[model samples]
Target: MKKMSKLEAVLWNIAFPGFSQLLMGHYIKGVLFVVLEFVMNVNSRFNQAIMYSFLGEIEKAEMVINYQWLMFYPCVYLFSMWDGYRSAMPADEKYSFLPFVFCAYFVTVGLMVSPKVTIFQVHPGPVFLPMLFLIPGLLIGFFIKFLLAAKLYTK
Candidate 1:
C-alpha cells in the first residue's frame, strides 16, 4: 500500500477508522482504533453515572453536569476537530496540549461559578432544568464530532 503523509494519516484516521494507519502504512493502529472506540464509550457512560450521582447536592450537580457539557465537551470536540483538520493539511502541525489545559480550567471554573451571579430565576426547582438538555446535548456533540472527523480524515 502507498504511504500517506502525517497530515493525511491523521485526517484519514479521524474520518475512517484505521484509515490513518493505513496511510501511514501501519495496519496495527487501525485495528487498535476499534478497541479505543469501545473504551471511550464505556468511560463516558461511567462518567455520566458518577456525575449524575452528584445531583443530590444542587451546587455539585450543576457543577459537574454543566461543566462537563457546556465547557468540557465543546472545547475538547473543537480542539480535536482543529487538530484533525490541521493534520490533514499539506503541512502537518504539531499538537499543542497547553491551549487545551487552559481552556479546560477556564471553562469549567467559569461555568461552575457563573450561575451564582445570576440576578433572578423563575423556576425554583432545586435542579437546574437546563442540565437535562445540556447533558445529552454534549454527548451528542461528541458523537457528531467523531463522525465528522471520521468523514473528513478518511480517504
Candidate 2:
C-alpha cells in the first residue's frame, strides 16, 4: 500500500463524507458513508436548510430541518474524517483521534444551541453556527492531546 497523507484524507472527507475512505482504499466503508450521507441529507432536508439559512431565513430553515436526523451528521462527518486520517497514518500515532472526537462533540453542542445563539444580535443560522463551535472543539481536543503527550513523555 502506498503511503497516503492524512491531510489529503481529511480534505477528501471534507468534500464528501465517504470520499476519504475511497481515497484510502476502503471501498466498502466509503460506499456506506456515501449512502448514509445521502439518506441523512434527504431525511433532514439539510440542503434546503442550508439554502434558507444562507439566505437569512432562519425561521424557514428551522422549520424545514429535521433535528433528529440532522443531529447524526456531525458525528458521522467527523468520524469519517478521523477514520480516513487514521487509516492513512501509521498505527502508532498517538492521540490522533482527539481533535475529530472533540470536534464532533462540540459541533453537536453547537447544533443543539443553534436555535438560541446570536452574535451581535444576528443569528448565525444552522450551518455556520455549528461550524463556529468547531473551532473551540478542535482547540480543546488539541489541548487534551498535548496534556496526554506531556504525561506520556514524562513517564
Candidate 3:
C-alpha cells in the first residue's frame, strides 16, 4: 500500500492543527498547548463575564460568560492552531514571547478597563484573585516555550 505524503499530513494538521503535530511526533508540545488553550478559554469566559459586570453590563457579561462564541472560542482555537504550527516548525528557530505577553496584557487590561462600557460592578471575591495567579502562569508557559525554542535553535 502507498503511504500518505507529508503535504497530506500537514494538511491534516491544518484541519485540526494540533492533531497532525501529535501524529508527527511533537506530543509534548501539542498536548500541552491544547491543554493550555482549554484552560485559557475557560478563564477568558469567566473573566469576560466579570469584566462585563465591571463595565456595568451585567446581562451582557452573563451572556458572554454563558454563551458567547464570537468573543472567545474562535480566538482560543486560532491560538492553538498557531502554536501547533509553531511547534511543528524546524526546531532551530527562536520564537518570540513578547508578542504573546503583550497580547495577554492587552486583553487583561481591556477586560479590566474598557471605557465603552461603564464598570459599575466590582467583584472582590475569589474569582478576580485567581487571575492574579493565572496571568503569570500563562506568561511562564509562554516563556517555557520560548526557552525551548531558543535552546533548540541556539545549537
- The segments of candidate 3 whose C-alpha lies over 4 angstroms from its true place after superposition are 1-24, 39-58, 62-85, 88-95, 115-155
Give the per-residue lDDT digits (tens) of candidate 3, residues 1-155.
22334455446644653565566576876676567555655765755766765666656764565333323433454455545545445555455434344444544444443323432564332233333434664676577777777788789
Candidate number achieving the greatest lDDT relative to the actual structure: 2
The order by descending TM-score is 2, 3, 1
TM-score of each: 0.30, 0.95, 0.35
Candidate 1 per-residue lDDT over residues 15-97, each given as its tens digit: 64455554545567545554554454354442443455454444544444434434434344334434444444555323233
Task: Tell me the whole-model lDDT of each prediction, alpha carbons only.
Answer: 0.45, 0.91, 0.51
Clashing residue pairs in candidate 3, if any?
Answer: 54-119, 55-118, 55-119
lDDT of 2 by residue, 18-106 (tens): 99787667889999999999999999999999999888898899899999999999999999999889888897889979999999999
Please give the lDDT score at residue 13 for candidate 1: 45
10 residues in a row with least lDDT, candidate 2: 1-10
Model 3: worst 10 consecutive residues (lDDT sum):
122-131
lDDT of 1: 0.45
Q: Which regions of candidate 1 deviate over 4 angstroms?
A: 46-155
Against the true structure, candidate 2 reaches a TM-score of 0.95
Question: lDDT (0-100) at residue 107 of candidate 3?
Answer: 45
Candidate 3, residue 23: the lDDT equals 67
Which has the better TM-score: candidate 1, or candidate 3? 3
